[model samples]
Target: MTRSEATASTTGTPEADEYDVIVIGAGPVGENVAERAHANGLSAVVVETELVGGECSYWACMPSKALLRPMAALADARRVEGASQAVRGSLDADAVLARRTAFTSDWQDGGQVDWLDSVAVDLRRGRARLDGPRRVKIEAPDGSTHTLTARHAVAVCTGSRAALPDLPGIEEARPWTSREATASKEVPGRLAVVGGGVVGAEMAVAWRALGAEVTMLVRGERLLPRMEPFAGELVAEALTEAGAEVRTGVSVESLRRPSTDRPVTLALSDGGQLEADEVLFATGRRPRTEDLGLETVGCEPGSWLTVDDTCRVKDVHGGWLYAVGDANGRALLTHQGKYQARIAGAAIGARAAGVPLLETDRWGAHAATADHEAVPQVVFTDPEAASVGLTAEDAERRGLRVRAVDLEMGEVAGAALYADGYRGRARMVVDLDREVLVGVTFVGPGVSELLHSATVAVAGEVPVERLWHAVPSYPTISEVWLRLLETYRG
Candidate 1:
């Protein structure tokens, strides 16, 4: 039978409104899972209460990048002598906000919904909860409810939400989460950003460029604490150079805003107080499983779902439940979540067809081994920070005998030509026992595009001798590879 015919035969049947796969959440991860299942001749339906494209499309990735790009472009131009002469004015905050809104399609999901229809993946606009094994109860926006049974699997991809601290008067103060930070139409004259992770650092760069006096108050000693120490140090130095305040080793004791018209007063942990027109609490994220009725399936509500490499939930019986993306807590990155979705969808399809899951081993078609070994990320600050796989500290902690090679990016002909006074660093950690790179980090302008090559090297575990044969074109930042190799040899 044709694919559509096969899907039609199994979906919305008269006996019971059932599908081969009932995917909870219509985010990118959930969408990929449903699409893959449908491609494998299984009928799939995705349920989402919010926008179909989810956080990345609206609040996190798309809008955030849209806001950051203009500033980065201007900075790039300022680094070049002739271009710097032409760049005269500050960023137009209104124009930047308009561009950001345009990227989000003004917060509408009609296009995403249309795409789902085109792919033959049914979409149910509602909040969904686990009824039991292979069963889901959906409550529609209009208050109607229905239960759908999954013939093969039910995958939860309901991402995460910003975790606000339990500070007194926080709710009344009305702090901004990532969503508000990215979506706000107006730039506050004075903005206080809490936390120093990717969201905190990037938003600080974005708003500060848009005419806000940005002050980053980090509880930790540095920004981007998860990456190499130098990465955070570089970002903090840049933020300070750009006139934003980077205050580390500080915490908010309490927050108070007497009225909507007034400013927020933050009582600091060091017995000091500061005020800001707006405060963004980019603290952390919490899973969206509290109301998903996980208790019905013997899983604790509001807890991260434990999943194997195949993205199958471990605690649930029958092997019919799957959780991908941030829900699984494997890797919170959007790309990594999509990767897990593809693997999980294939595993579900194979099991439904009574086929043996032969590719369940490491680095196999059904396994998400990259989550543990070669996750790649790029922080899009002024000088982008990109890294893949293990950091040197991570490799050492894992008991791997590794030698780290560091190189000044300015020494590269390409980097020098890319910008005047180009300041950046590159590092590669090699597994001495294996003679392969276990980690690679690049901190410089336009380094985001250089990440995939490192991702391939780490994921492929290509031998150092073979990498030497893969020549880098001269006068490019990629030539840093050759320099790193030379440094390693010396």
Candidate 2:
């Protein structure tokens, strides 16, 4: 049958309610899962309650980065000699918001929907939940309901939602989550950010540049508690230098907002009070599985699902239930989720064909080894911090014999030429037993582009001796690689 005919037969009628794959959520991860399953000769249908492109497209990644770019460009220019002299005015907040809206296509998902149609993957606009093993029930917006049975597998890709802290009068305060913080159209005069994670740090930087008096309240001793100590230190220092207050070891005990037009009053655990036009709680995220009908399949609702290397959920009796992306509680990054989806899709196809699962070993076509060994992340604060694989602390905790080598990025020629007074750091954690890079980190201007090479080294497990033969071009930040190698040798 033709692709369109196949899709119609699978989703057009109540009698024809079976597909090779039933994917819940239409975010990037779910889209990839459906597309890959269809490519592998399986009919697939995706169910979504929100935009097809999910959080990254409309709110988190794209819009947030768009809002950040203008400020970053201006900051980069001021770091140079001739450019600094030419730099004159502050950021255009309205223009920044417009550009951000443009990136999200003004919060419309038509383009994404069209792309799905072109791929011949069926789309159902609704909320989905597991009825039982391999069975999914969708509740459409117009109060219609339909049930779909997966001949092969059901994949859950519902990502995550912002988790708010339990404090007195928090709900009444109606504080901003990451969604509100990224999608806001206006710049608040005085913005108070609680939590010093990636969301908190990036929003503080973006809003401060957009002319807000930004204050950061951190419950921990420092920001980015999961990354290396210096990463948070550098970001905190930069935020402080940029006229934002970074208060560590403080928490919001309570919040009060008398009316919509009034500012928010926060009672602090340190026995102080502060007021701000808006308060953003970037505390954490919880899996979007609370109402996903996990209880029907012997799993708890609202809890993260555990999966194997091939993304198969362990709690389910049959191997037909899979959970990808944030729902699996693995790496939460969009890129990593898509990677898992690809592997999971292939595994489902191979099993249905009654063929041996292809190369189920580490780093194989059916394995998601990267989720554990070589996950990479980039935080886009000024002097962006990027890291791949493990951190020094992670390595030590894992009981690996490792040594961390560090170098001042300013000492590199390319860095000096890039910025007048370059201030950043680079570190590589070497596994002593294997003589390979177990982890790598770079914190400096324009270092986001340097992440792939680190990811390659860690994922490929390139030996230190072999790395010596791979030469770096002169007068580039990548030359920091040579410096790192030299430091490791010494």
Candidate 3:
């Protein structure tokens, strides 16, 4: 059925209300689950206490991108002075924070209610914990308590939270997490990011743009170790050029206060310490499965709830009870979680309808889909890194016969206009036997917009020859696609 037709219709009086599905979270992934379930003729209810858009809408991606966009535009303004006046170099910090507050609707959460109304899905304002299989207990804001038993299935899409590593004096200090970083209206004078991962780098650039001195400390030798070495190199370059210092190959030995008026100091193993106005722990995130009633449902005790190909939170007995999104500890990104939620939602709906349940597979739309294929990741810094598919090392590890090509991106016409002396990198990994684009990476200013072409080609398994026919628009940053393809021929 078309999405429009899935808008729920009134079926009964207020006294008699029941649903086919009770989704435990109203995050983006959970919202999608409700829509997909409703589309399959199963009544659904989404329970959430926080803003309905969850962490992504309120904190993570939306606000981060909002901040990063101006950084990119400012870089553009420096070149074209006429437009610079219109573009404005000085980001009214207060104005931008006002805009961010407006984006979250001033924390009023009315926008999310409108979305649920538009889709005709029911929303419950409360925190949900599992009571049993297919049972949920909700604790509401007004000190009211309620319980629900689903007629069909219970799907958990509760996302993750920032994990504070076992660092000495970390919790006592209460260093800024993503919550504080995203919500803070005032930029710290000196900021030290504890992890060199995606969150650390993104925040490092963002704070730097706001006129804050920033430093990034990474345990790994390079940034974005999940990506190819070349992509990591370009990100390191951009961070350094942005007036932030990047220190790699050093573990933070300890963190504590250097003085009463001073910021927290990170003592390094190399006998050096850097003082910062605030320390942000972006080391990683752990699944928020605590008090989730996984034990009542016969799942494991750890934060992670293991799910199979179809995203069923397979119990300790290796049976079916699925967890999707960050709760599953697989992919933490908002989009990927929504992608997996769709599969879990569909599988549950179809199975109960007495139809054959579809098994999840690499290319199958019913699976987590990105599990076996290109999972696109973009860090929305000024000089962004958008990467998908396998790396050269990943290709070789899988024992695939692969040929790799790397090209400096400034050679392209797109890069010339992107920045005066554009210093981006584009690399492609080709599966020799398959003759298809197995992987793609693009790093530089104005490159995030160029990522989808590569994602489409890689996920569609389009051959390099067919990709040649898929011409990128002229004078756009995407022409780097064509440039990299030409280098493959050379």
* lDDT of all predictions: 0.92, 0.91, 0.79
Candidate 2, residue 363: Cα displacement in angstroms equals: 1.6
TM-score of 1: 0.98
Task: List candidate 3 stretches off by more than 4 Å.
Answer: 1-18, 80-89, 258-262, 316-320
Query: What's the best-to-worst order under lDDT?
Result: 1, 2, 3
lDDT of 2 by residue, 1-35 (tens): 33332324444335578888989999999999999
What is the per-residue lDDT of model 1 for residues 1-490, given as tens digits with 9 covering 90 to 100?
3323222333556644688899999989999999999888898998889998999999999999999999999999999999999999999999999999999999998888878777888887788999989889989888989888998999999999999999999999999999999999999999999999999999999999999999999999999988888999998999999999999999999999999999999999988888999999999999999999999999999989999989999978899999999998889999999999899989998999999999988899999999999999999998999999999999999999999999889999999999999999999999999999999999989999999999999999999989999899988889999999999888
Which segments of model 1 are wrong by more than 4 Å? 1-12
Residue-wise C-alpha lDDT for candidate 3, range 235-276, written one tens digit per residue: 778779878899998878788874556678788878998888
TM-score to true structure, per model: 0.98, 0.97, 0.92
RMSD of each: 2.4, 2.0, 3.6
Error of 2 at 462 (Å): 0.3
TM-score of 2: 0.97
